[model samples]
Target chain A: MALTRRDILVGGVGLAGLTVSGCAGSPTTGGRPIPVQGATAPPGSPNLLVIFSDDHRADHLGITGEVPFLQTPALDTLASEGVRFDRAYVTTALCSPSRATLLTGQYASRHGVQNNLSAWTPGTPSFFDSLAAAGYRCAYIGKWHMPGDLPDLPGVERFVTFTIEEGQGVYRDCPLIVDGVQTPRPGTYVSTDLTDYALQWLEETDDGRPFCLVVAHKAVHHEFEPPDDLLGTYDDVAIDLPDEAFTYQTLLDRNVWEGTAGRLQTSYRRYCETLLGMDREIGRLLDAIEPVADNTVVVYTSDNGYSWGEHVLTGKRWAYDDNIKVPFIVRWPDGVTAPGTVSDAPVLNADIAPTLLDIAGVPIPAAMQGRSIAPLLRGEAIEWRDEVFYEYFADFPYQVPPSQAVRTDQWLYVEYDRGLAPELYDTVADPQQQVNLADDPAYAATRQELSQRLADLRREFT
Target chain B: MSAAAQSGAGAMPGEAARSGPVGSSSGRAWRIAAPAVISVVTFLAIDLLLAALVGRPWGPAYPLSMDALVLLRMGPVFFSGLIVWPVMRARGATRAQAVVGILATPLAFAIVSGWRAAAFFPPLEAAYYSTNPMVVGAIGSQVSSAGVGALVYALWRARRHRSGRPVSSGATPLPISTGWSWGPIVAIIAGTALTVFAVIWDGGQHLFYPWVLLYGSLFG
Candidate 1:
């Protein structure tokens, strides 16, 4: 059989054949059925598309609770069909590092990546590498925040990149670093252009092969701008005032609105408007995939939660739920036997790697810190990893005192090594965490237990 | 460089379908390169706009001049790092087709250099370490004292880059037919030596010496 450059160049046609013909069907070469995965027909292996939003809070979702007029029908459809974890968290609450955690399935500290600034060059293997090793053609389509001398990803094909480099505001026609050359997308909004590229890949690439496509959305992030078409979609929804946001203003008398750092500059109205485009974009995306959605498993979650009038902080990197909790919903109509089961149990963002591999029927590596949640999806009884740890390294420069905590079934213990006063809250008793239990003598045993556990977790993290 | 920023991120859309104003009858041939060129122009326009916005918040431009020179200075380091991937790729590197599959660095460095060099130099420091004013002051004062000296080493890199050529394809190593293989390498080494030796007359210098010269010339 002759292999021509034309076969490879067929991708130049945009709809290249993904099927690798089997030797079993060969007329001349009589061989036993040498089976293949993505060679032909429908992809025997499932496709995984993880849509990660940067600095987006879980509560902002319309389906999560009462929200200002926010439309996320596509995401809502995902929640209705897949197992939506109510409590999902990032190890480090920064952009690049959190992204690293998702790739590495390890905490930022463990991965040797602490913050967005400076070099966090990866020596560890990313989940994409593992997927590639398992014969999946992986691709990252948007929002690559991994800073400084990015590792040459072996198996992962980065078709496009929205830089996480500083001062490169996440806005329209933002310089997209593609194949290493910093170029631009032809559109008014960067998100729209990114989605366009994403859909193009979907339409063009042969879906027969198992693929890991990550579409990291830049909208619902800073200097918020929604497309003009969807600006009126949520213009009337009454915004729910979060408890942490209004009360925390007292702590910032010294640094009121003048608060300057790497904090997300967002307003209630602006954030709502910015998210409108994402909601509709999400809707449109689901519409495109809904036709042949059986084989595809779409995982929707944010890199880290953002504060919109929450804690008056205006960004991530707090022990508060507003910062850590992300909306995690996985939709696999054919894959999951039980589709609409909601799991309130704590799930770590790190779990994403193992879970994906489990669903793909690939073996989870021992090096990965995350455990698979495939059982939860299949409604199988499984032992859960209780007491998930939380971490927040200062994103705004010069702010030391890294924040760390451990959240169990009932308790939320936070230790602030940075100058902020440490606090403990009974999430079960006071859902809002309105009362501080760190100083109360009545809560001594709980405090001691939490403190020791937090210490032990720290030791484990190191 | 600042002119690029004025375009903003949302410079235009549908550049693919709409042909830009072509002056010559050779428009048909030029149209073939149009999509690639249009995409690049749109992306750079956004980058420039973002850069401009950043400049407003930070400065006029985040110059890569000295840093480019520094990277050029650390050509050995960057190239050395490049080997890890090439070797790893040769071995069991799982991901076969990376965006920066060896050829990206040169292209990226060239783009960063051609656009942001000179003006974007002296990468933001005073604003970065705003933990305490002392850290800020220390960095600012350091910038003041160091000035062009901060970039002398990076400046020396300009001569080296002038000698090299672009690797046209992502698959192959850049051909070395145009660059001064031995002569310019030695000349650069000598030139760097003389500059450092001159700085030593005052005191030992840091990396910012070249940038300090720029500041001095501007002020004087």
Candidate 2:
């Protein structure tokens, strides 16, 4: 049948309206249980697959308006199919510290992984162990930047992690440690290779027991390198620099603004390119798990938020929003009914373990600092913490001074321990944090209150 | 130059003889162009106001002061004005037409620029944060400037009327056919030099430095 212009226009509009209204179909749930011999498992223990990316900021997602032209269809599809947390943050913006928080559900101080160099001694309790104890099979793949001497862990039966280029992991030709065995990879793209192992495990794992899989991608990090196929996809696209880039008053003393601004476009383009490759791999993973998708609780997030000179600084050690805020999207078909939902309630990397345990009906350890946000995911009203504590103990020789901050919904109080002036921002009014109200007489009362609250938080967490 | 010398005294400047002003008698161009210019100016003013309120820096920090930041923010808007003025003048727009264009700058500036910004950031969030006094103050300056522009145009017209000169399109024909002007040629040379310096000194991102900065802020 021949279609008229009006018909086409109407159909287009209708399709767009549906997408905007989140008309994506809900996943199937309550399937027949897979029987396991000699296992005392709860009726429907859903599988868990956590897809973690390194140094990815929250806004970088296409839906977040980070880079306007960058299209992350896979991630956008995931958010539309699940719940996206708008205020998700990391305890520390370093790789190891943040990863440790995800593992232990505790702050850096409690976990003893204060810096990137600090190691988590083998047998230190993680929620993975709890899942294993509850008759679930666990596997970890890709950039396991968590510090530890032993390649083996309590629950992770398959440990396929990359360790090359001083633990940053290489984009290409990277070596992998597969269950304590050294494997040389020649000219293999790291993310693709890691996914290969993860899919293999997902396919070969004993079907009786529910599984926990971690797939971490080392894309979109510093020295941004995309796969060969994606290298020139964004070469012609123009990037709009921010207004602050012109008059970078914050970097005037350092003489680094011009240098940073000049290379910003090339660096950011490479970043988007790399992210695209990762997104493609994620789509493949989703395809591979299509049958069990509804019964699996899929979580996607980053170890830490990264910065490409938002504050005239490149890297993630700072207390800025871009450096600490991370994209957090969780999809559990059986449990979460509110599809395409956005949660403004504060959540942290430390909350991952407790929440996963809660999902699996396991008891949260008393030692865990984070409370499970399972109720929040189910769209239930639950009393939640108003503030999140953030700490970055000095990377001493690197000159990154130690700082602790308490970020409430309205206020942000940062105290630098190196005798630097404190920073206080009324986030509701000044989201970009241009004006520091720390020393302002008008905000003296608010400052004191936030300071006291911060002190109390430090005492509670430490 | 030869065209202006041949035409009568009422002829406007800076044009080829045949292209002085199209359809001047019907006033169609002025009717179309006047509101458009006013709308743009008003939108830019509002954009600046919202920018101040949001306190959102569009790009990375540069090595410039607060005053410099303010100037850089205003630069593009002013540059657009430079292009708009000559077009309206050449169209033989009346004093009232020019006044309407000038006076309508702030609101138009806010609406247009605000719309553009909303595409990148949430409109409500952008507007909510833009409730700063500094943004209001910036809007005030824009409105005041537009008011001043209208006043100047009115005063000039009144003076011409009092002197019994015909209310002709005030544009004067430029004498470019005789010889090239030193001013524009020198500007072109300077601009070329600056671009060359930008390519060599500023990370080689773009040949034109300001364009690089502008593009970088919007999409980078």
Candidate 3:
């Protein structure tokens, strides 16, 4: 059945009603939370620390070697001591949709955050609900850009996020909403301030019960404002932009669409500098968790990848690799048997919730669409997905068409709405996706198969 | 004793020499080009001013509302005719020449800025103009604002004529009896067609494909 605009609005209201009524928690199981397949964790479960950044490209990390000049020592160290899924991507390449997918372990369609304008369906089951029920203290920190106001999540004991500037919080002196109270932090950078709050929670939460903390940073997003000390860190480095980038692409993009002003190279340098600032904060959080490192799980990733002029685009929501792929590194000393293992298995943002739930020995909810990669982390032989599906809904005021794509180890197939032509690329031959093979006779069979598979995945997930 | 008659009789010596018949090709060209130049300058001034106000000076940050910035940028385009009208009168243009100059201001501003915007990635351009509400709103604002500005200028000129007040520092007003020529009309039509052709050529399928879809849905 086709979902009309009315259906979406009604569904949102119904979900909000459920949230207000506190229907997420059950009275029967004594709140111990029975797992779908196995026993729930007891009092002392491993802590889960998920450090999520905004718009950090998959290749910008120092460990990735994709950008040699990029300096991200903290992320590099984390990857060195963890498992980096080199091909991890978000199901949706927009910030709100991808973040919703991360929390819900479901696609944007199922979660009802199909665009930035849509909010998280209030009663939707998140890993936080499961973790909270299973004797874990959960907290969501930093930027919540999803519309319909900052949600009152049942699972989160503390919600430290901002609503200033319509949830795209300022880079400096950002206000904070700490557990229902508005607090102002004057002259503090957003990344540093958010990380400081995360550290404070970690130090103050002294209960023997484990904790689930999401430190979602707003650094590296648009405006690309780095902290004062790291502002000009990458000013001298030569920016390696794609050949498709026009001379005035970034200038027109900023002045017209984004309503800002900057050239490509300057904006890119500021983006890298901002990432460096976030990296320093991540280093602080890493140090804070060192005492409990053995019994903790640390996952580092971004909401979505940003484009620095690749395909002549400057922002996210495109199905291109620069917009969808993200840096996914997991370090769990107690869970991951092998350190420094770079897995070739494709992962999605949807998998993060299920994986964290599985690590905490909490029940992976039956409604969750993603499969936990816990066995893979344990170095156990397990069957994994061969391809990942991606979806992006059209965001108003931003001109990117609604698109769906299926990416495998060897190919990527994309279909767009509004009568736009489909795109198909042989990943092995064209990693940059410069050529479209949808109409090529030699790749006709491959395109047909991938198109069918994409349809199948969409039906199955939604 | 109309305002135009008073201005003609009280003309300064230098103004009398400058205010000649609109039939001369060089004089007509200047009349057309002057308002167009003024329109472009006004637009650029507004764009730059807004950029400085909301945009971060030391870095590549714009922490303010984007909707406000975009709306503010449209202000100069809408009132462009009024902004260029005083300059047209100061140049001692005939009534027909002044009307042409006022209409040309918004057209020139729209075409120049639209061309720059269309130079973005073809697919992005197509997607943006694909029946997007913002595009519709912007176009509507431009047309209506220019129309309103022209109407106000015409009303003010009529009121001044009826009251028999001199319009400005008096220069000889060219005769309104000057026969209408096809030159300005042909130029406007040719300029619009060329811009359309250039945008279509540059944007290719990315520009045309979505419009085809929209047209098919609307008409068929």
Candidate 4:
């Protein structure tokens, strides 16, 4: 009873069939695969490549000052090549909600995905849908953390995603659902595998139609699992930790506790290590699109910001800058007039959907609550928001109580829905959110105005 | 085996003669432990369902670490005994009664959770659960657990009967009259209303007057 080559081939096909069946109804898989048009860009249209990362802090990059010795060459290169947004913030500093905002160009309230335990309304118009309708090939690769268990996405020509245990996919030997088939044991390093898949997609896709590929990375998220090559990257590096003002112990004592207190060095080191892998993946992504670089709009950002002992907070869902602000760099070769420029315009996750639509030459839907920043990207003069509003809903895991805030250039006014007292800060003077001026008589007028403004914005948005 | 054999005539020499349908001591323990195990499994399923329906920001990889989810889920399990024990202690306690008793706890918790969510976290209900993920998840999880609990009981019963042990006599299935009681129907309606409000109705003006024009007024 010796097994022949024919038997082995049949067994292999059977295994493949089982794998495909497992991922038959996965949310990340798009429509039928389109043949590769060509290596070059589609005529008169630029391809869109958005490299999204999870739990990435704005200041953790080499250019940003969180870690001095850390080097994120790919991200730094992206920043150098395009416009970096200094004031980018997520409307709701959580993952699914923020990602929904990014996709729908709507606030958490409008999109109805206020928390991770929320689902985006199926019929809600997304930029990708509009792009696909306009004959652009849409492909979403990597982490697809939306609700409905990552069901078939609309307007996507190709969808590949992580199918590991839950939330963010596993870091090593990640389960990848490619073209609605769960590729078993798709070996090591999620970011690298994602990049390779993205590259393969770009190589295989029909280049006749312009494409939009969302290359998301599940790095720097909790557990901070890094590949073997990057495991000891920053382990030996001496890093300057945050001072007493931002100790988890201080937060615990103050009764505003969130985050790990003593694991600053270990956490930061692992974070940097994981981040380096993502950076290399970005480099690889960039390399993949090199042939069509001139005709591609490459954007890089995170779903939500992370906190490395900032305000004693370990993770996001806080109104503080560390938890809400994310690194945003867009390299649109044809659209951006001045390269390596920085825009201080207060942009948000919601702005992304509209912005993508604008780039793809699709009409911004009326359902979108965010204003397109295409003008800002092209270095044009346009009226922009002076203040950004942030909100959080209380759930079980991240016990940072539900709070709302309105942050201006100079002031930040926080209103807690439950637990703790309200906080008002002159961000210019107290950038660390250390001082509370809510009860201070001198700032009563400012607080009153900001509160009124916050209410107004909430009413307008919600 | 005949009734005599089932009553322990078939027992080995020094072994205690089997009397009732409950087979071994372990089998009896299983009968007692089945409800507790079902309760935990059902609640875990509920939590997993909620996470999946909503989207797990923390993801499923680390279910136990999600402090909020754990607390939310544990609340029902901790208080489940208040209902389960009472039902189990009722007159004519049987396998069906125990199954129903085990499931009643989650149902009560779901209603309480719905009401509390509507009252306190109105904004959350209005935003995230507008499409009713919570309601569907809660019910789906509750029913799933109930099925699992019944299965466990059924399996244990089958094993006891298969072992030729005489089952404890006089224990009857839930009466038809009791099964069709009005309490469950009313509870279902009330729970559905509360869940709907918590998941859909806004606590603002929408709470008072929910009707809104979808395509503008008829007068244009």
* CAPRI class assigned to model 3: incorrect
lDDT per residue for candidate 2 within B57-102, as digits (tens), equals: 4434332344354444444333322333333444545544543443
Candidate achieving higher lDDT, 2 or 4:
2
Quote model 2's TM-score for chain B: 0.36
Over A13-99, each residue of candidate 2 has an lDDT whose tens digit, in order, gives: 111211100122221121111222234458678888899998888988888776777878888989988999999999998888887
Residue B14 local lDDT, model 2: 29
Interface RMSD for each predicted structure: 19.5, 15.7, 13.4, 15.5
Q: Pick the winner on lDDT between candidates 3 and 4.
A: 3
Give candidate 3 misplaced runs (Cα > 4 Å). A1-44, A251-255, B1-18, B22-87, B90-220
lDDT of 4 at B198: 35
The candidate that wins on TM-score is: 3
How many collisions per candidate? 33, 38, 0, 16
Q: DockQ for each candidate? A: 0.02, 0.07, 0.06, 0.02
Q: Which one wins by TM-score: 2 or 3?
A: 3
> Which candidate number has the best lDDT?
3
Could you report the Cα RMSD, in angstroms, for every candidate shown?
22.1, 18.5, 13.3, 14.4
Arrange candidates by lDDT, descending.
3, 2, 4, 1
Task: Residues B56-146, candidate 4: write the lDDT tens digits.
Answer: 2334433234334445565454345433432232222465555555555545444544443443345444332222333333443443343
Q: TM-score of predicted model 3?
A: 0.71
Candidate number with greatest DockQ? 2
* True-vs-predicted CA distance for residue A367, candidate 4, Å: 1.0
Predicted candidate 1 versus true structure: per-residue lDDT over B67-171, tens digit per residue: 232223223212322232222222222223221222233243334433332221222321222212222222222222222221332232233345552111111
In candidate 2, which residue ranges exceed 4 Å CA deviation? A1-39, A147-150, A246-262, B1-220
